[model samples]
Target chain A: MTEASVRRVESLGASELLALYEQMCLIRRTEQAAHDLFMSGMVKGTTHLAAGHEAIAVGASAALRPDDYVFATYRGHHHAIARGATPEECLAELMSKATGLCRGKGGSMHLTKASTGMLGSYAIVGSHLPMATGAAWSARLRKTEQVAVAFFGDGATNIGAFHEALNLAAVWRLPVLFVCENNFYMEYTPIAEVTAVPNPAADRAAAHGLPGIVIDGNDVAEVHDTVARAAAQARSGDGPTVIEARTYRHFGHSRTDPAKYRPADEVERWMARDPLSVARQRLESLGVSADELQQADAHAAGVVEAAVDAAKNAPEADPAEAFTDVWADGGSTWRT
Target chain B: MADVITYRDAVADGIAREMRRDPSVVCIGEDIGAAGGVFKTTVGLLDEFGPERVRDTPISEQAIVGAAMGAAMTGVRPIAEIMFSDFLACCWDYLANEIPKVRYMTGGQVTVPLVIRTANGGGLGFGAQHSQAVENWAFAVPGLKIAAPSTPADVVGLMAAAVRSDDPVVFFEHKGLFASKGEPAPPDHVLEFGQAGIVREGTDVTVVALASTVATALAAADRLAEKDISAEVIDLRCLIPLDVRTVLTSLERTSRLVVVEENPYQGGWGGTLVSIVADEGFDLLDAPVKRIAGACVPLPFADALEDRVIPTADAIVDQIRTLVAY
Candidate 1:
């Protein structure tokens, strides 16, 4: 990391640091509960958890305004939670309950809460990049200062839509932020096996004629400070910025994956740099007491427990509701 | 209040009218600006809407459709052009998987008012890569509304309706019909999606066709008059909202059905139309339905081979005569 960037990270106040730590804790706790639910067979289907990469979601989303839009990938529970989606609503949607966001139509991978500006989450890798770019174009046409953020993985940067979206955004000077959370692995394959470059941000941004910033994603202060600057630049009509956060995922790609492909030493190393623990250490060094940190952890645990309870009790979605929402005209007589 | 205009101008006029009517309407495609598009359908859109609204994009169909889908969800009506229908294969994932399922997947929380305009069909000698009648591929997708307008008037009306539609509309303009001139549609004319236009009403046999095939069917109807066959030609403006009522009504009078399409015979849209009739209006039929379509092979570049592959007016007339004889 550059000395200048490190100095900027140190500029964050104590309360902001505490808030970042609290959000990271909440995400870690919620994802653990989700993993437990999946293992217990309470949650059907596969889920990609973002336990080790919480700081990127929490920090980058904290930089945007409440009205600004966020387009996230399938591993998106953290993105939604960081953007102010209630834990109960997110868990219920994962559980396929009617009261959940998207009314249970989109479960786990496709969580959407328009009220919080968390536009739909996509499962297809790098596909949502163009949509996010389009959203930025819409903002430009409407003359709004709103910035659109696309949260994708390192794997997505290699996809055709990623390059196309970035090129379009750069050419049109659209207000969009491309955030690639480099989780070191694309499912089970190491990124180096597929991608030619060690870091995609600088080369890609240079190709598109935009500023590219890379930071230690495990550091919440660095992630927040860098994203906030990029968001401000986008809002000021300086076109898009590519931000690559170097991070890792503690769990396997999905519920069924055991991540045996990963080396044991590599897992230990990433686990040591866990974003939650990293933030907690930062808070401790900033004169926060251990008791206060423990209390915050307990609070996050309580929130996750309550969310799980609510999701378990929520009613199953109605079978007839499937026919609805297929068309906006509601003239579809296929059901009738 | 109607003037004569080419099919290209009719498409341009429809898009320009929608842009002027709604401020949120924007056009995004390759060479659609100063170059006026490959087919010149977006000839004057760049000057009228400026670059902000009429955007010339890179050769990226996935991004173009994805951007339009994203913009549509955010209250901006985007009319994205894919240059050629064959190029849709490059971004079929976005069209088949993403764009069509957004509204339904979101439980109607968001509506994609997106129009994907592309030139389809063969006959221009653009070869296999350029010329293709692949509307059937898009027709198979559930949520998409597919439109294939035959004349300038129908093109204008369908284009306007597609722009105003809340669902994703795939507007297919035939390459062979671009130069064809016809009466312009009225300023406020927006053809309802599920309604079919009966170009020539008759009683012996009902010939259901779409886009360029509609012209072929109309010519066949005229030749059938000489033979006293009295063929009915139904111009299916859009395929998604298949106008079964009109086809069924025509079938009630004419018990024989002959479906024609520019695509191949196997798994083509003609098959779907034939299946619908066979399943629902079986008792009304006097004979087995005949489907006249392109040969089941890649469209060759040679004119003689292409002519042999595509169904001509004479073929349609012969098919009708056989169905009428039955």
Candidate 2:
């Protein structure tokens, strides 16, 4: 927490601050709408909502270029939307329609749009960290100044792949930014209970010879400033940085869990500093009028409503697609 | 012209051939850089391709495979070595759950065009942990393309095809066959998948094998020929794009099938061959289909005990005699 750099909010232009606030509003609206769709029985299975973690995706992605790659976890709607995947397609993927991000093949958990540099949203925990390293290495080999970002939860830091990926990235001096969204809980259990260290990601960054960074994930300006500096270091070939964003998940782990484990006061305390509220206050202090903030919320709501309609109108994916895309030849046949 | 070379040298030649042809081709593994790999299969790769193209990795199988998968998705063709075939279990998640399923999950947005080559099977008393033949482990995964070459020539040929394929390929090179000599594959050699080579053609029994068992089956055929029992040996070059047509055709004339494999009996890859034959060519069988597989037990350390567990040339000969008698 002490090590990460954060500048005052006055440095960001009024237009840029408004854009970041709009992005966070967009994610908040999208995940909430997804929650409604699931409760209405329109979206099946389960959804991992990112209600309070909006600023991390929005602020972090704002610092990355379009060519830079992002590997996010299953609860990655915010990351996908931030990286330019249309809300219509991401919602379509949730509704299992033909027009989805993964064309309905990867429902709820997996959402991939390589065209947008949203490499994928992997459901399996702690798996894609090394993948990000590989992409960064490839960028270096091609002489491109591209960097790769991997977004995971606090639980992933304890996994073997996490250590291996960090060590390899450090040893190779790869342009990788490992962002761990530490929301205090890994599913139902408190991450603090299972984790050996107090700060899972930042505390161990020194072992890999990387900077130990912890930031106020709810503050959009702080997140933006820290990630931008980390990205700059990476692009300049100074190697990776580990950032732990201390936030809280407003919703339960999934659609099924009610998350009754938290004390009422603890929940209330975190909700008081909700990312949307924090960003709104930041906008107000930066001279954004109250009317403009209302207009941003209105814009977010309108886009989500239109996206829902467009996705609902799209037909179900064809059964033939199930057999296709299993191989490069567009066929699953492995034998004669 | 390097007229004759061992199977291990051919492995290096295959990777070098591809690396020379495509700049995107890169090789990485433990001790593969300057030490030339534990089995010396990757010797001369580092000196020839430089440290960038032929790089060494830490003892992290997941990172090696995962990095290769990511590199492939981002346009670099990578070839990762697992050192031993049994060590694939360490990174089974990347191979079974990640690399193979990427294209399908992303709806063809990515192509994991990578090769994972490892030293496979037992003959030199490496014992249980290092000696187990686990190609069957990868064979069960649907999206992977499996290749187990029995000779130096097939090594070069299959390595070319695996590196060029748009899908992920798991290549198994026999540790026992490293020293076996054969004519070197030409520089331009590129064999396709699904084409099984007829090592020795005959008219009695169809003996089908892959990698280590291919040599054992060939030796059995020679002994069977002495006893007036002609055996046709079919070398299945690639497992995923399996040439069952070749096996069915061979069985068409022979009317009897015997599957020889180094994997254990309970869930070996031979079961797939037997099932397909029973389903498609059941009427072509004159006797019950026989499976000469490695004993369902850990490979022992002693030479005699190890010989009992792994399928040997004499074991293949004895089995073929019993099947011929039936």
Candidate 3:
């Protein structure tokens, strides 16, 4: 999908467009810092950065309420930030500090903050699909007008949980939106190389009786509009819908890989359509001043700097926390 | 009031009572509604409560558990049944990941008050595919609570308790105990979690058992008595929230421990019990903790092979003899 074919969902004023650009820039700067820390051995463990895929997170998160639940894959830094988590809390989690969202136990892959309705992010491939469906189902049963959105890669469409969750959501008419960020590659393998089905991952939803849509992922406006419609459909109890966003991950799958599987030319082609630049241009065309855009960029850089400082200063996790949250109070008597 | 009832009836009655007490309580499983469950534990639940409450689902273990997690999170207390414990492997992601971690992941924004009841253990000649005890799998999961009851009274109490819990609980019912008859204690009798029930009290050695092993332990305790050895038998009501205190207390008096379980020896709950005793109560132990677990072999389809794979009273008595002599 080309950027020219992408249609803006909602026309944002100059201020709103600038805010969106700033948010996307903030995600990029924060994740870039993480990549540097990971390279320097300061931050440990595998991190699936959201640097290349900030537009989807920023645009989609803008369409939902804070009370609605959101589930994401391992690549979830942007999702947490866009869902209103402070960059400090998210960075602290990546740094394995005590004040992290999971109290340092979950690290990068399992970071979660239920207070902000970021239900949780899972490292397991398609595991959280059913979980989001269950949460959405719960909301409907309780008469809550909340919706559940699960963000996964194209690779997840082949997993059993994806199919099961979609079918269950359709049969029960549950309030769920399955967003497939078809980033072209499952780690080293491309979706076209792995998936036998010719259509987009969203097309698979039609078999489950839910409407499906394909959109240009690099276009923030398109992602925002498509997800807004899907979220609305879910909140209205119109069952589930699948939105396939054709995007790309510029970096390697994990910290270790440099994405040798993709040709350099393809990566360069995707970099030209960088999501943050597109959002910035949209705002500029709508009469936003160059000074205003620069101010947003500087402020976003400041947020990133503050987050890094806070994460570095955060305390270490107490060894005793290994025993907590296993169950509710009086839930288990296994001694420390 | 005391009444004679089968283990299945006692459990069914517990479900009926809980449904009547809570308007949001519901049941979902295969053949549970119109078919009344394969073993008839829910024989008339659909008739007593409408299909809305006692629901029969398709033969999808993943869906059964996933939907129950969804329903429970929304305020409905769901009692989901997997036809056999062996089938648990198919839907393990839902049980181990989603159901248990939902509340913690949601930061207490929601609660998964769900119960997954499945029959386990061998003796029905159902073979390896249908007759494996998978309670150990549940024991490994963090946020999941596991319980296995031996007597009709404990069955009723524990089933009710499992539903009342806000955490995800995996309740394992022994297939062999379904026909075992016992006196039903009062319907209001509630057996708390992490508390062991001393079925037969003695002082020579403490025999720690759970589920079907309780009966074998009792029989072994009787045999030990004839041999002039007093044996204290304690039934572990809940496995995960294990009654470590009861075991410690029993060992303080009895001075020896023997854990009998239906699962294989390696990575089994019995191993966990032994580790606990060795780690915490080493100074008080008169002898090493002995474990009489199922043979480390795939449960055979043949009756003779299956019998050999499971622990019997003879196996328990033999292990106790070794522990006592030591």
lDDT of candidate 1 over A11-39, digit per residue (tens): 57878888778888889988998898889
Better of 1 and 3 by lDDT: 1
Q: For model 2, how does the per-residue alpha-carbon lDDT over B208-310 read when each residue is reduced to its tens digit?
A: 9999888889988988899999999999988898788999999999999999989998799899989999999999999999988889998788998988888
| Candidate 1 per-residue C-alpha lDDT over B265-301 given as tens digits, one digit per residue, 9 for 90 to 100 | 8779878787888889999999989999999889899
Per-residue lDDT for A1-336 in model 2, tens only? 454354444456778989989888888999989999999998988899999999999999888898999999999888999999888988999998999988888877888889888899888788999999999988988788999999999989989999999999999999999999999998988998998888899988999888878888898887888889899999999999999998999899999688999889989999999998998888888799999999998999999999999999999988899999877899998776
lDDT of each: 0.88, 0.90, 0.82
Segments of candidate 3 deviating more than 4 angstroms? A1-14, A330-332, B23-25, B43-55, B67-77, B94-112, B223-229, B279-289, B318-326
Q: For model 2 chain B, give the 10-residue run with minimal summed lDDT.
A: B100-109
Candidate 2, residue B71: how far the Cα is off, in Å: 0.9
C-alpha DockQ for predicted model 3: 0.40
TM-score of each: 0.97, 0.98, 0.92
Supply fnat for every model shown. Answer: 0.62, 0.71, 0.30
lDDT, residue A108, model 1: 87
Q: Between 2 and 3, whose DockQ is larger? A: 2
Query: On a 0 to 100 scale, what is the lDDT of residue A322 in model 3?
Result: 63
